[model samples]
Target: MPRSIWKGAISFGLVTIPVKLYSATEEKDIAFRQVHASDGGRIKYRRVCEIDGEEIPFPEIAKGYELADGRMVILEKEDFDNLPLATTKAVEVVQFVAEDEVDPTYFNKTYFMQADGPGTKPYVLLRDALVKTGQCALVKVALRSREALALVRPRDGLLVMHTMLWPDELRSGEFAAPPETVSVSDAEVTMAQSFIEALSGDFKPEEYTDAYREALEEVVQSKASGVAMPEQTEAPKEAEVVDLVAALRASVEAAKKRRAEGSAAATG
Candidate 1:
């Protein structure tokens, strides 16, 4: 099992479930390190003072908040510790709302809320309750040195906590003008519905593969073996101007063809 990033309790209406938070996702992208190109040496960065042009140690650094008139309010570690918000260690549930009411765009990172020792009963109860009622718990959690608003919801059979974006941070529809509705013929609407039906399939996430990762691995392997790298091919160019209605009709026909072929292959 992966190491737990945080150990905490989920609090709701006098009930607290001890849970270990584990990251739900992992980044597998190829990473490149900063290095000196000529000598192949690793590049290093230093914290230097803008005024004095001197390198400063980590211990000498203090947090600062910029003001309106180019002035800074420097703060020591003790200053933050004395703040009222810092004293709270518990994950406080503020409210429960319908899970569907929450917009997905507001969701940031996700963490698995695994039951800690003797927490299985309450954890399962909360999970079942959420599944049955279709409600999500809006909670406030202090993690990574900052207070975060989160949504605790059921995913599969486990509880997942997703950090929510602040209301002010979300863009409102008032920024853009509303779109005009266009009327479509019955024949076109029927064809579009048929296309959607043709394209429908089970959402098996495992079926998806990262072609870029595979290509990168192949390139790295070839270079490590001292083999000459193949020349990269340019992607085919698309038409600069496209007819929306024609494209939709063509896509529908393509989907229908794919579905027919799949059905035929299944029978054969």
Candidate 2:
């Protein structure tokens, strides 16, 4: 069983469902640490005051908000507690909207919501209802010392709470306008459509691999084994000017050849 990161409850109306939050994803990439080159000692950072040039302890650090230029209002723990909010240890569902209505770009991190105690029946019912309706529960949840908007939906047999980005945080109209109306040759259009049909296949996430990461790992392993490294060769540059139709034709042909070879290899 996965470890629960947070313990909370879902509150809708007067009913409260006790639940625990668990991480839905894991990082698998390699990580590095900063170290002194000469002594091989790890480097560390300290929070220090710029004016006094003195290290500030965690206890001395107080939350502050700048109201104007060079002016800040320091807030203590008690001051923050007085702020008006639901403050309930529950994820309060505000409304339910069609899942398609929510932009995918608004999604942030995700966490699994598991029932804490003997509330399995209600939890399962909620999950099933969400799946059947194809809707997501927009909720307000307070976690990690802040309030956040979360989308609750069913994934597998569990409820997943995905933190949503604020509307102001999302930029509008970043895409370019559609090209001006243009005429296309019937033969060109037919060939392009045929090429698309020939190259199309079911999307498979597992088929994608990070070649750069694999190469980096191989280099690291070789260095660790004291193997001699080969001299690197620079790849040739692509043409600055390209004929779109010609390029598309070449790509389609290459894809067809690759697929045929793969099929033949499997049969062999």
Which model scores highest in TM-score? 2
Q: Scored by Cα lDDT, where does model 2 land?
A: 0.83
| TM-score, prediction 1 | 0.80
lDDT of 2 by residue, 1-268 (tens): 9988778788766767889998898876767689999997999999999889999999999988988687989889886555677733678999999888888999988999998787677788788888998998999887766788889999878999998878888887747656568666776687688688887889988989888778788888888999977878999997754565776687689889999998899899
Which of the numbered candidates is closest to the native, going by highest lDDT?
1
Q: Against the true structure, candidate 1 has what lDDT?
A: 0.85
Q: lDDT scores for all predictions? A: 0.85, 0.83
lDDT of 1 by residue, 1-268 (tens): 9999888788877998888899999999999889999997999999999999999999999999999999999989887656677214567889999988888988989999999998899999999998999899999987776778899999989999998878888887775765568566776677677778778989978968999999999999998999978888999997653555566678888988887897899899
TM-score of 2: 0.81
Question: Clashes in candidate 2: how many?
Answer: 0
Off by over 4 Å in 1: 69-71, 76-82, 172-190, 229-246, 259-268
